[model samples]
Target: MIRSLRGRLFLGLTAIIILTGATGGLLVYRWAFREAAELQDSVLIQLASLAQNGSFSSGRPLLGVEEDTDVWLIELGATPRGPADDRQLFGLKDGLQVVMRKGQPIRLLLRTRPDGSRFAVAQPTAVRDDTAREMAFRTLLPISALIPCLMLVTAIVVAHSLRPMVRLAGNLDARRADDLTPLPQAGTPSELHPFIHSINGLLVRVGLLVDQQRRFVADAAHELRTPITALSLQAENLGSVDLPEEARGRVAALKQGMQRTKHLLEQLLALARYEAAPAERGEMPLIALDSAVKQVVADLLPQALDRGIDLGFQLVEPHMVRGEPVMLATMVRNLLDNALRLTPRAGRIDIGIYRQDEAAILQIEDTGPGIASPDLERIFEPFFRGSSPEGDGSGLGLSIVKRVVEGLAGEIALENITGSDRSGLRVTVRLPLAADRPNEVSGAA
Candidate 1:
C-alpha cells in the first residue's frame, strides 16, 4: 500500500534484514546452547576425576571450583547405606547420569576407586540449564544490535539511489513554459536512460505541434492582410465623399474599425514570427540598441504630441545587441503604444537605455494608472485586457513585446511604480549585451 518508492524499498530491505538476522541468530543460539551444555558436562567429569585423586572427605564443598555451579563432593560407601539421596547416587554406574537425589533431579558422575569405595560429583539440573541459557543468550546481542544499524543503512541507500530522479523533476518544474529542450541523458545512471529517452521524444513531438500552430497563425494573418487593406482604402474613399452628417460620422466609424482590424492582423503576424526562433541566429546583426530605441521613439513621437503627452529619452548609452531591427522596433513600438493608450493627456513617459552588469537595460516609466495587482501575473497573455481596460486597445501589444524579448534572449519585468507623489507602471527590459559592444556609461540627459 506504500506509494513512495523510497518507503517501499526501505520497508522491503528492512524486512529482509530482520528475517535473515532472526534465522541466523536462531541457528547460532541453538549451537551455543548445545556447546554450553557439553562444556558443563566436561567440567563435571574433570571435577570427578580430581575428587578421586585428591584427599577430599565426605560431603565437602569443592574449594577450587565455582560456587554458582553447585558442584561438590558426596561420599557413598562401597555399598549403599546412607539416606535416600546418597543411596540413590551410589546406585548409579560410572560416568555422568541424571538421577534423583532426595526427590530433586541432579546431574551426577559416579566413579569407583581401586579400594572398592565410591563417590559422586553432582550439580542441580536447574542450575546447570540456567547457566547454559545465559551463555547462549549473550551470543544473540550482536545480531539484535545489527538489525537497527542495517535498517538505517538501507534508508540512506534508498534516498541516495533516487536523488538523480528527484533532481530531474526539479529541473523540469523550473523550465520556462515555451522551452521544449530535450532532457539530457549523459552522466545519468544506465537504468534511467530509457526514461530520459521517452521524455525527449515527447519534447520533440510537442515542439513540432507548437511550430505548426505558430505557422498556421502566421499564414492566416498573411492571407487576411490584402482584404483588410482594401477595406481600409474603401473606408478612406467614403470619408472623402461628403454625404449627410450622420452618414459622414458612420464612414468615420467604419474607417476606425478597419484600422483596428488592420492593426490586429499586423500584431498577429508579428507575434507568430517572433514567437518562433530565428532560422539562423548567426545571420542577425549586432545593431546599436540605443539607436534602434531612438528610431522607435521618433516614429511614435507624433502620436504622443497629438495626445499632449511628453515622451523622450532620459538617458542613452552606446551598446550593441544581436536582433533584427524590425523585430526590435516592433517590440518597442508596441510597448510605447500601450503606454500612450493608457496615459491621459499631459502625462509623462520616460525612456532610458544603458548597460547594467552583462545586459543592456531598457526601462520605460509612464505617468498613467498602473495595472491591477491581480492582472499583473497574466498581463503578457494574448487578448487578456485588464478587468478595467482603459481604452478600445487590442490586448496583443504586451504579448507581442514579450515574444520579441524572448527571441532576443532577454527578460521583461513590469512593476507598479508606487510613490507618495505619483503612481504608474514601470517596465524594465534586460537583454544580453553583444560581445563586441562598448561598456562605458554616458551622462544622463
Candidate 2:
C-alpha cells in the first residue's frame, strides 16, 4: 500500500534483513547451545577418570575447577557416603547420569577404579545450563550488530539511487511554459530509459502542436488585413464627396473602427510571430539599448504633443543588450503606446535608460491614475482590460510587451507609485547586458 517507491524499497529491504538476521541467529544459537552442553559433559567425564586414577587423593573433594563451575568430586566406598541425598547418586551406574542432590538436580559422571572403588564428578544442572545459554547468546552478537549497519547502508543507497529522478522532476518544474525541450537520457539508469523516452515523445508532439497554433493565428491575421484595409479605404473615399454633417460623422466613426480593427490584427500577427520563433542567444546581436529607447520615444513625441503630454527622457546612458533590434523596438513601442493611452492630456512621462549591476535597465514612470490594485497582477494577460478601462486600447499592449521582454531573456515589473499627493505607475525592466559597453554616464536631464 505504500505509494512512495523509496518507502516501499526501504521497508521491504529492512524486513528482509531483519528476517534473515533473526533466522541465522536462531540456528547458530541452537547449534552452539548443544555443542556447549556436550563439551561440559565431556569435561565432567574426564575429571572423574582422573580422580579414579589417583590423580587426586581419595576422600578429598577437588577444588581446582573454577568457582562458578560448581563441579565436585564424590568418593563412595563399597557402600554409600555422605547424606541420604548424596547416597542416592551412588546407586547410579558408571558413565554420565542425572541425580537429585539436596532436592536440586545435578549431572554426575560415575566411574569405577581398578581397585573396585567408585567415584563421581558432578555439576549443578542450573549452572551448566546458564553457561550453555551464555555461550549460545554470544553467538548472535555479530549478527545483531551487523543488522543495523546493513540497514543504514540500505537507506543511504536507496536515496543515492533515486537522486536522478528527483533532479529530473525539479528540472521539469522549473521549465518555462513554452519550453518544450526533451529530457536528457544520458547518465540515467537503464531501467528509466523507457520512461524518459515516453516523456521526450510527448514533448515533441506538444512542440508540434504549439507551432501549428502559432501558424494558424499568424495566417488568420494576415488574411484579415486585406479586407480591413479595403474597408478603411472605402470609408476614406466617402470623405471626398460633399455630404450632410450627420453622414460625415458616421463615416468618420466607421473609419475609426476600421483603424482599431487593423491595429488589433497587426498586434495579433506580431505576437504570433514572436511566439513562433525560438529565442536563441547566439542568433541575437548586441544592440544599443539606449538608442532603441530614444528612437521609440522620438516616434511617439508627435502624438504626445498633439495630446498636450510632455514626453522626454529623464536619463540616458550607453547600455548594450543582446536581442534583435526590431524586437527591441517593438517592445519599446508597445510600452510607450500603453503609457500614452493611459496618461491624460498635459500629463508628463519620464523615461530612464542606464546600466545597473551588469544589466541594462529601462524604467518608465507616468503621471496618470495608477492601475487599480485588483487588476495589477493580471495586467499582462491578453485582452484583459482593467475596471474603468482607458481609451480605445486593445488590452494587448502590455501582454505583447511582456512576451517580447521574456523572449529577450529580460524581466519586467509594474508597481504603482504611491504618495500622499501623487499617484502613478512605475515600469522597470532589466535585461542582461552585453559583454562590452561605452565607459560614460550621460547626465540626467
Tens digits of per-residue lDDT for model 2, 50-169: 786667654345657787888888777667877786587668888888888778898888887888777888888999999999999998888899999999999999999999999889
TM-score of each: 0.82, 0.82
What does the lDDT come to for candidate 1? 0.86
**Over all chains combined, what TM-score does candidate 2 have?**
0.82
lDDT of 2 at 17: 96
> Candidate 1 lDDT, tens digit per residue, 280-364?
3456667788888888788889999999999998999988788787788888888898888888999999999988999999999
Tell me the deviation in Å of residue 311 in model 2. Answer: 4.0
**lDDT, model 1, position 3:** 100
CA error at residue 395 for candidate 2, angstroms: 4.5
lDDT of each: 0.86, 0.86
Clashes of each: 0, 0
